[model samples]
Target: MDTGMIIQHRRSSNIHSLISYHAHVGAVTSIAWNLFYPRVFGSSSADWTVKIWLLDCFTPIQVLDLSSPVGGLAWASSSSTVFVAVTDDGRAHVFDIRLCKTRSLCTQQIRQAHWPALSCVVFSPFEPVILVAGERGFILSLKLSPNLRKLHKEARGADEEKLKELERQKMERIISTSAIS
Candidate 1:
């Protein structure tokens, strides 16, 4: 299998290449940037792996294997460390790096008997819900439980800068811990 590569370009500087990531052993299926962190992103692949990466680092900070080809992935709008991935096996996998890095927090089948494989996933910007799209034009919306979302009461009162700082710290902690392990 050909190794999947991700090339980063400087968006403003004449579209020049800035960095390259050798992400997976199969085609890269999807890429999603963290809503709160400019430098953090995640990529899913046909090789059945989803990897979280930092712009300055060549290596992935964390990797999750789904045991089936990943169709697509999207970062949660409410949290910097949370994301959801859809797979060819008709399931949606949710991950929160703060809660666990080695395995998904939830894996639920979204495709029914006659439905096609899931092709993409997107989190709602205003609510704790996600919409998964299947290859055959089927779209399903799922509401996330409070535990999966981890929405704190304090976040409502916190200023944007403060919330961003907290999120940055959370991501930093994950990176530091992953490096140690």
Candidate 2:
């Protein structure tokens, strides 16, 4: 919102504008409603905060703070406990915000963006796969099994090998393209 307030509208009825005011200090950039928890939704703003709101509530149940402004935000497709937000600095921050919780905290990040600011991020409805859109004209679909617990193991083993293999494949493609040209 231009006045730093997030509003909700009712659908399929004559009624409209459910809430009169919200708690963002700057222009709100994005908003998302959880697929599983219809009463729960999220709002992100240029004020560098993300707020979790229950339906028909004026005060937020949770608020996440960041240094830079968030560009996009979305709730997990199937899980009511999961949510994520993306920023302009090539990062996607994830959170575990189940309902009736007292405090808010960030849980994880999807992955580093493609070396550019990310515009948006969405999770697949069926699986844990995530799609991230970058401002540098690219969209990356990543199958991230790199959970916080699995990350160390993957980094020590699978991830390094995969990175080497990908680098080799890129070099081969470059060489073949140069020869063709």
Candidate 3:
């Protein structure tokens, strides 16, 4: 078993420990930081769960159970509340927290059962596609449908700052609702 810890360091000083907790019962397989929100990140573990965390909290805001070992995970480049986690059983679990927090919005079978386990998943920054890699030297690119790529919309001529704030608020709402539930 491995514990998850966050650390911060400056160029002129030694690394300082921030918060440490038992994030998983098994080894953590992958960790990804949300591109749109600096304070939010996610971790997947062999315990068959993915946990979403906030920088200021020790407990995870949400835990998703996949019922199989998670090989890797990656946050979406265009949305703060969306991510994909690959499992050892050759399934790709796509989650959009804004739509549903209890389960993945969609699950795709990227590889056959006889094929090697998927090792990693990454989202394309320029498009609504994801590339999944397997342990046996195979890679598959998947194009997300319109439903999976749905994102919050801003008014016409909205500034960049306003868009960013909307993204931040979206994540904040999920976090707050998770706390209550």
Per-residue lDDT of model 1, residues 66-170, tens digit only = 999999999988788889999999999988888888888998987877778888899999988999998878888999987787655657789888888788877
Best by lDDT: 1
Between prediction 1 and prediction 3, which has the larger TM-score?
Answer: 1
* Alpha-carbon runs more than 4 Å astray in model 2: 11-18, 98-116, 146-181
Of candidate 3, the 10-residue stretch with the lowest lDDT total is: 1-10
Enumerate clash totals for all models, in the order shown: 0, 0, 0
Clashing pairs in 2: none
Model 3 CA RMSD to the hidden true structure, in angstroms: 2.6
lDDT comparison, 2 vs 3, better candidate: 3
lDDT of 2 by residue, 10-47 (tens): 66666555656556988888888866546667888888
What does the lDDT come to for candidate 3? Answer: 0.85
- RMSD for each model, in Å, please? 2.3, 16.8, 2.6
Candidate 1 has its poorest 10 consecutive residues by lDDT at: 9-18
lDDT of each: 0.86, 0.64, 0.85
Pairs with steric clashes in candidate 3: none
